[model samples]
Every structure is written in C-alpha cells, then in structure tokens.
Target: MSVCVKGDTILYGSDNYLKIADAADPSNPIEIGETSVPGDIYSITVRNEYAYLADIFNGLRIIDISDPSHPTEVGHYNNIYYTRQIVVRDNYAYVACEGEGLKIINISNPMKPLEEGSYETPGRAYSVALKGNYAYLAATNSGIRVIDISDPSDPFEAGYYPTEGYAYDLTIQGFYLFVAEGAAGLRIFNISNPLNIKQIGYYDTDGLASGISVEGNHAFVNDGIDSLFLIFDVSEVYFPQETGCYKTATANWSSAVNGELAFVASDGAGLYILDCSLAPTLLQSFNIRQAETKMELSWDISSREGITGFKIYRTTNEEQPMTKTTSPTIPITASNHYEYTDNDLINGKSYTYTLAVRDSDGSESVIGERTVTYKLPNIVYLCQNRPNPFNPSTSIECTLAEPAHLNLSVYDINGKLVKT
Candidate 1:
C-alpha cells in the first residue's frame, strides 16, 4: 500500500541533542542539518510539525521543525526536576516526574506552558504511556499506576497495581496494558475496567525487557543484552506467544511506530528505522562499520531508489560496535541485485558485518544482517543499551566505521540529565 520507508534518526543529550539526517529515501540517508537543545533529550513525541521533547531536568522543549533541516526551539518548561516521560493529548501534556510524581501542563500556547495540576506517588515515576483518556505510569517499585486524564487540568488516580519488583516501561493498546516489569518480565493487564485492573498474561525473555512498542498483533520488547527483539503475539490477550525476532544495527532501547514503520532509539547508535508491513523489511543502515580485519557482508535493500553505496559495520560481541566502513558507492539500477566480496579480509578469527545501501537522493537505510569470523577483531558495536531494569548505569556500545561524535550521559531515576 505505502511506498516510502521512514527511518528514525536518533539524537540524544550526550550528542548535543541533535542527530540531523534525512532518510526520505530509504537507501541513502543524508545528513541535512543539526541543532542544539537546552537539555539532554530523553523522550520525543511529534504532533504536527512541532516535536515535544522531554529533556531530563530541562523540562519539556517545544521545537518547530516545519522544516526538518532547520529545527528551532520555540518554547520550553522547566518546572519538573526531571522530565522522565511525557504524553500529550489535545492541549494537555502529562509528564511523569521522578520525585515530582505526575505533572499536568497546559500547552495550548506552545510557547508559554502552564502547570495545571500535580500528583505524588510512593516511588519515583520513570515512564508514562497514554491511551485514550487513561495515563499509565511506571512507578518503579511503586508498580503501575493508572490515572484518569479525561480532565487534563486535574488528573485523578483511578487505580493501581503494586508489582513485586519494579515496572520500568509500558505500552497501552485497546483495553490492555503491556508492562515491562523489571524481574516480572512482560506483564499484561486488562484495563477494560479502568478503576480495577486485572493481570491477564506474561512471558519472561530471561532478561530485563525495558522498552516496548506494539503494532498490530506483535509487541516488540527490547532485551537488555543480546541483539534480539523479544517478540510476542498478543492476538490472544490471555496468552502471548514469542514470535520471530530480529535485532537492529544498534542496541534498541525505546521503540515507537506508526502502521508501516517502527522507530527505535539506540542510545549511542542513533535512530533505527524499520519497515514492518506484512513481513519486517530492513530499510537502511546508518553510522559507521569497521573491523580489526577486512570482511565480506550481504543484506537485502528495501528501497527502489538507485542504490549508490553500501555501509558496513563490525563489532566484537554484537553488544558494542566500534567501526564502520562505507563502500566505493555502487549503483543499483536493477532489482534484487547482489553485490558481494570485501576481498582484503583477514584469514582466521570472527567479525560482524552489516550492509547499508545509499540512494540517489542521499538517504541511508538501516544495517541488516550480520556475519562473524574473518580474522576477528575485538571491535565494539553498541547494541541498544539493555537490561533496562538498571539501578544506575546501563551498558552502552555502538558500531562505527570511524569514531565520530560520541558521548554517553546518565539521567536520574526520573529522566533528568545527570552527567555525560
């Protein structure tokens, strides 16, 4: 149905808040522009041409990106200590503030944000996901707290369920709540009755599943360590089955999606955009890919654009990637074309290789597929920072063709900027 594939170009605080790239053309992504934000960007929600960013301690930053090439900050609010997560519906913005509980701000006037109301919880609230008029708050050890935001100016607590451990992140769909419970794995709750929630089902992926995003019948969960998306089939709310799973070029931390594409945020790896129509398609690969030794890699390209070049990435354990190498810019005027042979590869050892194609328009596709064992090099390829039930520091690594701009920052338990 849809023809174009969209990729998420991630930007974070440590990277100065902007990773400007244009992938309108799924194959070759071009760096169009870059700008600076007041705080480290933690979460981003786009409505219309404006992007609402929850920037840690910096509060909510309203940026006008009518022109994606020149994004300018138009407004901001610094009331909350740490703006961990946010959900905007109509004129109201619901924020989950660490120690501040839940904050309701009026953003009718994007420039001047006004505080409407606040509610305190037992533990620190880290993430907030909203569906319809209900706001689901991940209250860490305090569990999953549900609030009725039908009245934006004043949100009232409708109900809550205190889990055994901590609830880190959640995704709401239809009448159900998919929560990423730290040690509890993926907990499903029936919110058909808003006032009283009921646990429906769950599945443990043997790792702390941190960020989650749902589309159609599939719910994608980010496994803290490996390069796999703990896939779950939720056609039957009572029992979710683990479907097929795949990894992105980087460690996938947070996930967002429309009907056709999925945007995954990889801490140091930038944004990974994937196509999820009938069967998931690897759109394009960005960043750099390099190995201690040379290697050969192959991947499928999801674009009709005249493929110009392919980008390759390498790492040691698939956790932290350290090198990137761009090819000599081949032209793909035909379909289902395969370009192979890296030639100069070293003799023994193991290596990881990801293929990225470049389009005539300059947009880049995500790196899909991996190969190891070519005079192996101890390279660091940062996958999405995982085991997200993190008490403090979470392991982060990324693949690079060459070391470019790199910075890793920590936010308070509440999502405020701590350090770089």
Candidate 2:
C-alpha cells in the first residue's frame, strides 16, 4: 500500500489495484478514477502527466494520470522482478529491485523507458529516495546504501549505513536521512558525508514502522503491526518527538499533503484522508425562487461548528464582481434554515446569487450559486363607463403597466372601431 499526492488529486495503491481520489473536500474521500495493474503496487511516483509505479512482478510501469478517473498504462520495463520502490527525478527513474539492486532507466520518452544503468547492493533493496547526485536505498536487512547516479549508465555506491532493524522505507530532508526501521521504529541518520554517514537519533513507536513521509519539520510514520500512524516534530533532529497519532485497522503506507489534506494508505482499511482545516461539510443546499421583480433565496447549513455566519453575493453579469447582499452578515443560529428576499430587480433580466459560508477563522468558501431571470405578466385595467345608456356624454378610464401609444375612437355602443 502506497500513495502519491499531486494538487488535490491522490494516486493510492491497494494491493494490485491503483486508484485516484478527489480530496477537494478533505473530510470525505471520493474516488474519481481507477485501473488494474499486473503486480502488487509497492511504490508510486508522479511527474508531469504520468505516474511511475514499481510493480513487483511487472518491473516498472508508466501510467498516464492526466485523466485521473481513467488512468491507462503507457509503457513498461519487465527485465527484473521484485521491483520494490521507485523514485523519479528529471528524465530518469531510480528503481529498487530487491535482488537486482538499483536499476536506472531513462524515461525521457514516457512510452519507452530504456535501461541506462545498474548497481548491486549487499542487501535486498525495498525502497529508494533521491538527492543531488545520490540515491538512497532502504535495503531491508542491509540498511541504507547511497548510490551516486551522476553517471546514469554507470552508477556506484558512495555510502552505507546499517540499521538495527529491517529498513522498509526512507526519505531525505537536508542532510538527514529518515528511515522506517521495521521493529526498531523511526531511525534518523546524518549523511552530510555520504561515505561517513552515522545514526543521530531514533524513535521507537512500540510497533513495526514500515512507511514514512516527511514535510517541513514533521514526519508521518505508519506502523504495519499496530496499525498506528505517528506524527513527529523533527525541529530538533537529536530528539524527534511524537506530537500526535491516529490508529487505523492496518496502516502500511505514508502521507502527502494537498492544502490541509493528509493522505495515508492502510492495509485492509483502504485510503484515509484527514482534513486539517477542521471545516464542516456543507451538507444542505442553496435554492432560489423567482418572482415578479424579486427573488426568494433560501439555504441550509449542516452544522455551525466552526462557522461564524454566511454572506450572500449578487451580480447581474459574471464579468463583474458580485456585490455583498447580506447586511453585516447572517449570524449563526440554532435553526439551520436561512432565508433572504431581494426586491427591486429588473424584469426579464437574469441575476446570479452566490452563498458563501464564513468560518470563525475568517476564511470563507462559496457553497452554491444560481442564476434566474425575473419576469412579470402583462395586464391592463379599464374602469366602468360612467352614465350608462346616456345620450349626452360618458366618462371612461384605462390603465396599463408600460408606456405605449393609445388610439381611442368614440363610437356608438355597437362594438365598432374597438379592436382586441
């Protein structure tokens, strides 16, 4: 189980199947696309419009992820088996092939990846990470091995660090190499000098650490044995402290963030997406009812947990910015229903109304928008003719909504000269 995040889309692998999920609403994960692979997916790395996967029996497979919902395989390299993990940098992919060591393939052309180089490590390669001119391999029992890939066609090892436990995964930040040492937990190594790398600090998660991901000063580690996910503060490398943790059914993958979304691949449990924004889901809907020269707008909120109120915006044309229609703001209430009546709209004209939810943190997001044309029926009224049956004179009155030329002709009461 592994995951790769790009923008609001996530490419996660579950056994032999790969899928794309939409994380626009971090609270709920929605699958947008999927495809089947030949082998169990071990690792995934994305670049441009394609995703590179290390398919155990399939070697290396390049998938076109431009269309998340319908991802398709574009190319493959099946020379070696047990392809554990892969890392793509520039025009080449560095793959960790268990017994085959490290294999470099030039992917300048995504459809035809050509083998360019190879380096055999003393241990079985399970994972790989990249830096300037070095490639770090998480060689299960043999630990971390640094390979220099400056010469793609002829790569060589530059350093090696032996860990106490099985090294399942690894990541690099600055001069530090963070390794997920199976039973040994999270291990940190200082590799300023590739040839003289040394262990600086480590954290025992009390379980099996199989996957890890680092961003900024925090590291997210997944334990396969206890199904535990841990967050560490690595600001002080010597003492990486645990800040938070979430338990799943069987966590075996890592994390990558899009905005405030954190993704993890848990065995049996599938993919779990966390919304760090702590925003409520907009469950209710916004509706507009058209009336003569006016509009009746109503909307509902699922909950007002972190919400301060709501704001309504109005516009005649989308080319122009909408103006706020709500006064002050619609304050949160015990009731979920919110209604507002907008009057004095031009007849036979369209108007757009947008509803935005404002949070207590001052962040606001548009929930819904709708456009409607206002119209009114045509009608005219006429007063009763005065002095009925009078021979001398009679008074008449007529009223119409719009201005128009009127033609009047006085004639005997024989329904003459008056056209309907």
Query: lDDT (CA) for every model shown?
Result: 0.67, 0.82
Candidate 2: RMSD to truth: 19.1
In model 1, how large is the Cα lDDT of residue 396? Answer: 68
Q: What TM-scores do the predictions have?
A: 0.61, 0.64
TM-score of 1: 0.61
Cα deviation of 300, candidate 2, in Å: 43
Q: Lowest-lDDT window of 10 residues in candidate 1?
A: 1-10
Candidate 1 regions exceeding 4 Å error are 1-14, 225-227, 248-251, 275-420
Q: Write the per-residue lDDT of candidate 1 for residues 1-420, one digit (tens) a residue.
A: 001112444333333465456666635667665567776766677676667777786888887767778878888889888777877788888888887879998899998999998778768887888877778899988998888878776788888998755787887888889888866778888888877888977877776777777777778787655545566666555556564566766556566665656656665665556665544333422222333433434444445545576656545554465464654555565665454555444445355655555657797643354555654344544567776777766776555444468776768789999888
lDDT at residue 247 of model 1 (Cα atoms):
77
Q: Report the number of the highest-TM-score candidate.
A: 2
Model 2 regions lying over 4 Å from their true place: 275-420
- For each of the candidates, the C-alpha root-mean-square deviation to the true structure, in angstroms, is 25.1, 19.1
Task: Please provide, for model 2 over 105-124, each residue's C-alpha lDDT reduced to its tens digit, 9 standing for 90 to 100.
Answer: 99999889999999999888
